[model samples]
Target: MSMKSTVPSAQPDQFVHDHLPPPEQWPELRFDRPELEMPAQVNAVQALFQRAQQAGHAGRPLLRSDERTLSYAQAQSEVNRIANVLTVDLGLVPGNRVLLRGGNSVAMALAWLATVQAGLVAVATMPLLRAKELAAIIAKAQPAAALCDVKLQDELKAALAADAATAGLKLLVFNTGGAEVPHSLEKMAARQCEHSTPCPTAATDIALLAFTSGTTGTPKAAVHTHRDVLAACETWPRHVLRATPDDIVMGSPPLAFTFGLGGLLVFPMWAGASVYFPSIPYTPEAMVQLIGRVGATICYTAPTFYRQMAAFAQQHGIGKLRISVSAGEGLPDATRQLWKQATGLEMLDGIGATEMFHIFISSPPESVRRGAIGRVVPGYEARVVGEDGQELPRGQVGKLAVIGPTGCKYLDEPRQTQYVKAGWNYPGDAFSQDADGYFFYQARTDDMIITAGYNVAGPEVEAALLQHPAVAECGVVGRPDDERGQVVLAYVVLKPGEAAGAPLVKALQDHVKQTLAPYKYPRDVVFVSQLPRTETGKLQRFALRQQAMQTPSRNPTT
Candidate 1:
């Protein structure tokens, strides 16, 4: 395929396309495989639903929960009705943006699907975001309308009030938990026709604007096309995950996050599998219990989530559960061993980015290595490169560079050059590949901690700390030190019924020394009720670093 923009964009609203980086900034996209092929004119919802029906899976359950279950056919009707509400009632046009704010629920999923079906770009946001964060996203994406969960409308209302630009933006609420509200999406959708047609969108038309989680700094919107997401759906999930229609998927990552968007919705829809969203928020213990009670087969969450659930899994049953996916952050060997010992299942660890959309490196349980994050998915090319962008020899740690069907294209940000250079995407992670091509995660490039003369990775120390029974979860970072430049600081969340004090802190430091090099042990330890994390379940290390820099380090052993 040519790298040129051969197909015309069907979008009328040019805001997103206008804001996109130049063609030169795009990482080269390839759809070389047979499965990756699709027609030039593609609506994501239409493509997915058509694929499922072709597979003879349209009649099966596609959405599941205790309150309601919607099969593919039923969900299609609802999506049509919602699409009509967006286009007809709300007068939204193709390429207009719809801001979505909700928890992971059926109504939230329907809004996202309908937004794309109408050829309008969907900007799904985390449910926990406050008015300030929502205001930032609204300022960036400049959505024309917002579909908010009834329970979460307060913050969205505040954001709309806070931002003068959004004063004219219409707001509609749904998933009222049965509030009998008027002018809600459900009420309007109920009056609309259930046979609305899919909008004619070119495959190259922008489908959505996914903002970075901003672990490094200010959030940047990553532009993804209908073709880009469809291409991704073809690679990893079709080849590696291979979810069956009978499989029921569940997870904790918010739908706003790309990881959750793929794991909970897009990938499952591609396979015609069912998704089970807890009506209430999921706690580790509650999630473990619900997995068995609902008979879910596939689970998607981060390693920290799995670590918290392992203890509950021992007390509860994980009925019919098959695949457990770990992403959003680095997976520690200690956490992997604990999960395996408890459930007798080898976790499917993967590495993906918000920029690329989803996982590109992962393997089946049978092929999973002891410490690596599996080989790169077929249909993609990956290599470890030095700072100079030259490929590094195997077993040498360097920046990870990859190119595939989907790559990075930031919205109006100078960081576009930082992400894509010379047709390859740099995810800014440190990794080393083996002779067999297995990729091992080291840490985020900025996550490396330098103290005295030796360099250390925070995840390595966090991994070592997780080996201790008292440590439930932890995030490690570097704290400023006058003599050594910086010292290792670990913020820990202890297990239930465990106490935190000077003795326990020294014990954790000693354990890390035993597990890794003595110099890598955390010089400072802070016990928190819970570590700060993004809605996607990624540790908010930047937050921890801020706290560490503001306060003095505690070295009980010294």
Candidate 2:
């Protein structure tokens, strides 16, 4: 399976292009839609910069911190300088991978944008990733250079020392607090020109390798291109988000995740909007305070964060906040209602995957429904399909299948078959569609709890449990049972000052039974201080299931 290219790539290093999955393995990319059309030569970062200028926002705020703001003109100048530093100072060519390790800050965003602008593939790692995790990514991606925040360099330094593949990595540090340190990106950039030529990359050339956060198992890098990134902006932002230039965006998802990459950075740039980077990692109280302090218009984070921020937002005020986005996990109806009650703004919920780049299915803020994640985004087609790839009835739960401008393209992994099949991406989400085309999330395809021949969705049960005042967070999984096979079990974190005892457990069970079918109620409840979650804030049900394995259910017959 060979691909014949019509557009010439500017990439000098051919490593990424050579290692791409076979032509047949790529989920079919559709660019037939008028909005999806683009020039053969495209650099996503350059396009974003151009978009801001065309929208008459060159002098407007583009990046913000608590104490400072960078106008679009200033930001573009810095980005160009960094691109020059990457290609000139580091002696790297287009298509070389540059590993980026930082949080959601102006420095991290500039490094990522500059890497892509230079035609280099940016492999951005999570800020909180440990030495072992960093070592695994280094071994897999084998980046030729790294641009890391000085504050978070210890773990990466430890990882580089232990991994043979990092021996050749040329490292530069950013956010040095003006220290004249050697190998400082800021120092190199200052000596470089304030302008650099945008790499003449093909629209099809790789832009970034977004590795899955490894919530389920081993991390897999999902490949996206310049065309793919721009096309997604046309679909989700143009159709659903509709961000204006005046909007100031803030979020908790690290830029390493595509969710943050799009919501907090790319989409904002496309809309000629600015993004705020909190001076510190956001706690619920801090996030609420900063949103008001910065007058953030749109905010993005997981549903759990929304649930935690609701009380703080109600007390301190959400400021100029207009749009609240919930993703990374299913938005429980309880959290949705609670936030709406607190902020009077409907949460703009969406369902997307790292493989797809960004949200492909989300309702416009105007047409939000209680349980639905909205209709398929424009430029894409979606269906609810069964095991045999046949479309299931409108009301029945089935695997969610989607095909659009962007789809799954793993980096030489056998699991490619498991993600992309027959030209569609099965993002491992189970969903049911209504006659009106609205889709309701069931759970992760693997998160469905089977109890006594009846299937239960964990999110549905968690949503019900969250309705109880004492319940804070919960993860539901299937526990092995002696009599009825697997039974539904819940690991719950109760609110502060709430007693966790048999009576509270009974009350929680009764609440679920009242909220849903009695059979779907948790047969066993384990109280814990907190549920296991990935950095992206997705519940780690596999860990919970393993924890369940260690403690048998005692064959509880409810």
Quote each prediction's TM-score.
0.97, 0.98
What candidate 2 gets wrong by more than 4 Å, as runs, is 1-5, 554-556
Model 1, range 1-558, lDDT digits (tens) per residue?
533346687788999999988988889987778887778888888999998989998789999888899999999999999999999998999999999999999999999999999999999988888999989999989999999999899999998998777888989999876578876999899899989899888988988889888787677899888988788899889889989989999999888899999999999999889999998789999999999999999999989889889989988979899999999999999989989999999999999999999999988899999989999998899999998899999999899999988999988889999999999999989999999999999889888899998889999898888889898789999999998988999999898899999999889988988899999999899998988877778888888889899868666535
Clashing pairs in 2: none
lDDT of each: 0.90, 0.90
Give per-residue CA lDDT, model 2, range 454-549, as digits (tens).
999988999999999999999999888777778888999999999988888889888998989999999888899998888989888888888988
Indicate the residue-level lDDT of 123 in model 1: 97
Q: Pick the candidate with the highest TM-score.
A: 2
Which run of 10 residues does model 2 get worst, by summed lDDT? 1-10
Off by over 4 Å in 1: 1-5, 497-499, 556-558
For candidate 2, the per-residue lDDT at 468 reads 97
Q: Could you tell me which residue pairs clash in candidate 1?
A: none
Quote model 2's TM-score.
Answer: 0.98
